[model samples]
Target: MKMIDLTGTTGVIFGVANHRSLAWAIAEQLGQAGARLAFSYQGERLKENVAMLAAKLPGSIIFECDVTDDDAMARGFAEIGTAFGHLDYLVHSVAFARKEDLEGTFRDTSRDGYRLALEISAYSLLPMARLAAP
Candidate 1:
């Protein structure tokens, strides 16, 4: 059997906030397979975590990308494309939910919380796909 070769492929990993995050795990797998990587964080706190993880993978680039913002998302993909030229894969492992909604009845959830959750968790994927598409 021929081993699948991933060398020279570029992969962008979004939503890696900590060492234990799924995005981090996917990045490790992609890196081991010889894919060049880029990572995005939601904020400063997450950026710190992503930076620490990126340190383990020399040459990996990290960016601050709040998926809810169109400009930030556009800038992130533009920077990645400019830096890497092309991307072969994009991993979206980010999700958000208000603490109250995580443990309470749906009836208790506020309208704003519900809207925010859908925007961040569901709608975010659409923009990522659009930006990453060839």
Candidate 2:
């Protein structure tokens, strides 16, 4: 069978919670196609985990990023640029909200909860795109 070929593509993906996550799954296929993939995560623990898992995919890399932190975001993209020079695509499936906001009544959601969700889930895309764009 002929393999899918994306040999020159460099991609950045966010929100890969695990090997089974949508982002990881997409990245895995992209890697199979010979594309280079860079993944972003929010914490130390996740970085360690993704580092191990992403290693199985060809040319895959992990970047530490917390969408809530501007410095981390800037540094993460800058690092990716240093490694790949340019980016061909981005897969962003990130979302965050408090347990209460997601499980309890909408009326009970805190102001901070709403702000945090919007900032991380909705507003972060622009900057991520801007930094990663070729």
Candidate 3:
């Protein structure tokens, strides 16, 4: 068997809530493959947890980025650019819906909740992709 050697690869993973998050699993695998990684956490509450997980992988960094906030997204990507110069890949595992919105069928969801979900889960990729393009 051979291990994938991604020694010079650089990337970021979004939406890591904890060790159990699928995004975290991706991060671990990427790390094992020798990809340098940066993780984007949503808020201060998750900072400690994300930081702890990132520490397990050498050279990993954690930054705050709220997909709903364009300014924050810009700043977070800027930080990553400043740190890594360029990105080789991105992992977007972010998805969200209000708890109430998940209670019933999609048709029963409130307009605001649906919009929020779309913005966080789908629209966020656009700007992040643009930033990572260079």
Candidate 4:
């Protein structure tokens, strides 16, 4: 059998909420390709979820990181670098929207709600990229 070589490749997956998440799916594919895994979660609740999901992927490192916090994001990436020295790929599946915003019309969305959604769903990716960039 021919195997894909990922001998030195390291992958960091951000925003894995549960087993059914897109992040989890990507992590699975990366694992299949022999990439080492590191995972980040938003909070304590999600930290537990990520840890559970990561257990199936051997040698995976899981960390708590809220993308909205620059310090937390920086520390997370720094920790990953400390652990792995270098990284080859970073997968971002982070997105957020309030339940009301998702269910109701855009006209009904409050200004704060819109800002929150954009900040979490769209803007978070920029810093994540900057910090994780090789």
Best by TM-score: 3
RMSD of 3: 1.2
Which prediction has the highest lDDT against the true structure? 3
**Error in Å for residue 124 of model 3:** 0.7
Question: How many residue pairs collide in each prediction?
Answer: 0, 0, 0, 0
Name the candidate, 1 or 3, with the larger TM-score value.
Answer: 3
Question: Which pairs clash in model 4?
Answer: none
Candidate 2's displacement at residue 60, Å, is 1.2
- What is each predicted model's overall lDDT from 0 to 1? 0.87, 0.85, 0.91, 0.86
Poorly placed runs, candidate 3 (over 4 Å): none
- List model 1 lDDT by residue over 2-98, tens digit each: 2465788898998788888888998887787777899998877777888889878766898889999999999999989988999888998878889
Q: lDDT (0-100) at residue 16 of candidate 3?
A: 93
Residue-wise lDDT of candidate 2 within 1-134, one digit each (tens)?
Answer: 42788988898889887877877788888888888988898888788768877888877889889987878989988888888888898888898897878987898889999998999998999888777765
Q: For residue 128, what is the lDDT in candidate 2?
A: 83
State TM-scores per candidate. 0.91, 0.90, 0.94, 0.92
Pairs that collide, model 1: none
The alpha-carbon lDDT assigned to residue 16 of candidate 4 equals 88
Give the worst 10-residue stretch by lDDT in candidate 3.
1-10
lDDT value for candidate 1?
0.87
